[model samples]
Target: MTMTKKHLDSARRTLELEILALQEQLGQLDHQFDQACDLLLGLTGRVIVTGMGKSGHIGNKIAATLASTGTPAFFMHPGEASHGDLGMVTRQDAVLALSNSGETQEVTSLLPLLKRLGIPIISITGAPYSTLAREATLHLNASISREACPLNLAPTSSTTATLALGDALAIALLEARGFGPDDFALSHPGGSLGRRLLLRVADIMHQDQQVPRVLPQASLREALLEITRTGLGFTCVTNEQNQLLGVFTDGDLRRVLDLSLDLHQTRVDQVMTPEGKRVYPEQLAAEAVHVMEENKISALPVVNQQQQLVGALNMHDLLKAGVI
Candidate 1:
């Protein structure tokens, strides 16, 4: 069948209804929302999320959002909870249950056991006076005016409202706990943000024997040999005291060669870049990448507070370490 104006109009109406429902729910948040957040923030154990069907699917996403944003949480299917999964929760933990009607049998069936265990319950329900809401320690109203579905039978607007509320709770808790990007990176170690934040210069830089170094008095030819030996395409020009004086790279050599300078007699100091860009061992490799990018250079020497060269690194090193 050809897509027509009726279908288009119906789709637009559905989204408009959902948006209006979320706006209404946003207006409904009051002290109850704050109370739920306070309870979750005070928990010593993880937040246990439970629901049935669509709510369960939404709960899974909510739990993942919570976990990534500094809140320890996991979704436990309510049906599984009544069988034996209830053991996963303890008195120290808090439960956040979802049921638009606030009367889902599979979810409400765990009320007595949760009460016996003394675990605090925060219910997200459309029905304020339902059994689940009345029994909860804190009730968050996810009540929506109507479903986005034309039949008014599916959980379209209600689920969207619940998801938005879940996001609001997670972000509020994240800010209250002073959760920052570095802390978030810890929870996402395998992600690019973690690699950028956690990887340091010392972890990827070449140390000691791997560094190409030459005394300032060394001839350009000698520095060239050192660069070739280390395969770093550059050599650090240092004084007798081993303090970095300058850097001589292939680019410098090219410039010198164009000028017809005698490589065998020209001293390294004559062509070296004076006391150039440097990094520290404790600094993030990502910072090294920034420096390299800003200057359009491929290599850098790692130095200490005293300006002593401790290590060296290049673009290849960053790429190999997955920091680039």
Candidate 2:
């Protein structure tokens, strides 16, 4: 084979080997997985993940995924734990230790201390009968037939299986604990997912005087002034009780002009869109975007349980608020 063809062959072989390793893990999901989930779910404190070398790298990512998904976890390096970081692990927490051979010295050395603390231990190891697995409260088998490396000395396929197993544990615990997108969003407040799930219409809408509104009996000229003053592109038409009747927008103005109707002689109610689409203050801002996209309308009036106007928002407001 040419040099370029040789490189392509190696890449494909590596991926195929990793794929087979993950496929092997699928059938190994058994009762031990359930016990692992149960142990994590019952914990009042965080899930502490610890490992050495490549295993440690995978453990850090696993902890991050767990924390962001609502499981509440952090990674602890085994070498650090041996030094003084052992103080961070409490009896209320569960320890997830990763070691492909189950004989990693830095990790195994901390086992006796973990046992003395009465803390539960969960092991992710390739060797089911290794020392770490035997010492664990529960063991998850992340065994693969061989490493993707041609020499089978590097930690390639083994680390991938370990990472996948960790993800499986985190997701299972997330579902069992009734964790939802809103809960996940709270933990990730600075992210776009959080904005989509937690941002509400009340948080972004213009209220009170900022809302352009006119009485149903008002002339079209008066309503136009309200829309211009508030710059919301539309004005709400309400009755004396402040209940919404309809909306009049720039589009309505254009259509009326096309008909050669006298703007000064028109009543606001005569051309307003009565019972137009409305949203509640408590609805998600993302939902507001969905409504706007579906209706091809730029603005929506907010009403409360009593059907009285409380606020107003448009596509521009949502875009500026990052809900779009």
Candidate 3:
């Protein structure tokens, strides 16, 4: 069945209400937020995030963000904690407890153990006077004026407020820990941004015999043979001293054929692109990718400080390395 206009309009209205509610809830961030960050930043062990239901889902994501950003945190279900996961929380650890009404039976059940361990507790709650907040070492008021549901019961605005507060706490702790992109990338090594930031050009480029190159005085046939044998789709034309002189590629050969030139009689220097794009060996493979895209080229020759050919990389190399 197709969706009706009423369905889309209802969803949009809910989202709009949630956005405004979140904006209103943001005003609740105050001195308690700063003090809570101080407690988390001083932690030597992990941050134990515990919540119930929807709050548990948001807490899981918050814990991931906190861990990735260098805060060293993990989410432990309070219900599970009561059943023996409490062993995961050391005295050095800090706890982040979430409950919209400031009193979830599963979460409140852990307060005694948390107090016994002497672990600091940061409570994210709407009711500052509730049991959870009253027992917390640092109480962050995430109180929202109302839920986005017209009936004012479903967790819409309250969840948004909780999520925003969680993000603020994670980011604050990240800044306090002096976290940088490299630190962040270390934890997200499988992502593209991590690969781009952590991987070196030498890690992906064709190093020795795989590099396609030919002497400038070589015949067009010789260069074409090197390009085909290496499967780089291009060959670097270098002087006898191995200094790059030009580059010969399928595109250059296309232009050369248009001249109706004699391949057997032609030196690669005569038909190669004299001003073809080049990259330094020390440059990042990501930068080379950018250069290739900008110039609309498929391959680039890696040069040394002395402008001597050192390596050869192609778009295919990047593709094989999962970089492009």
lDDT of all predictions: 0.93, 0.93, 0.86
Candidate rank order under lDDT: 2, 1, 3
Pairs in clash, predicted candidate 1: none
> For candidate 3, what is the lDDT?
0.86
Q: How far in Å is the alpha carbon of 264 misplaced in model 1? A: 3.2
Return the top candidate by TM-score. Answer: 2
Q: Which is superior by lDDT, 2 or 3?
A: 2
TM-scores, in order shown?
A: 0.85, 0.90, 0.87
Better of 2 and 3 by TM-score: 2
How far is 270's C-alpha from truth in model 3 (Å)? 4.4
Candidate 1, residues 114-224, lDDT tens digits: the string is 998899999999999999999999999999889998899999999999999999999999999999867987897886778888899999999989999999889989999
Q: List the candidate 3 regions with Cα displacement exceeding 4 Å.
A: 1-3, 176-178, 191-198, 274-276, 280-284, 304-306
TM-score of 1: 0.85
Per residue, candidate 2 scores C-alpha lDDT tens digits across 1-324 of 899999999999999999999999998889999999988888999999999999999999999999988888999999989789998988899999999999999999999998998999999999999999999999999999999999999999999999999989888888887898788778878867778889999999999999999998788889889999999999999999999999999999888889888778889899999889999999999999999999999999999988899999999998888887
lDDT for model 1: 0.93
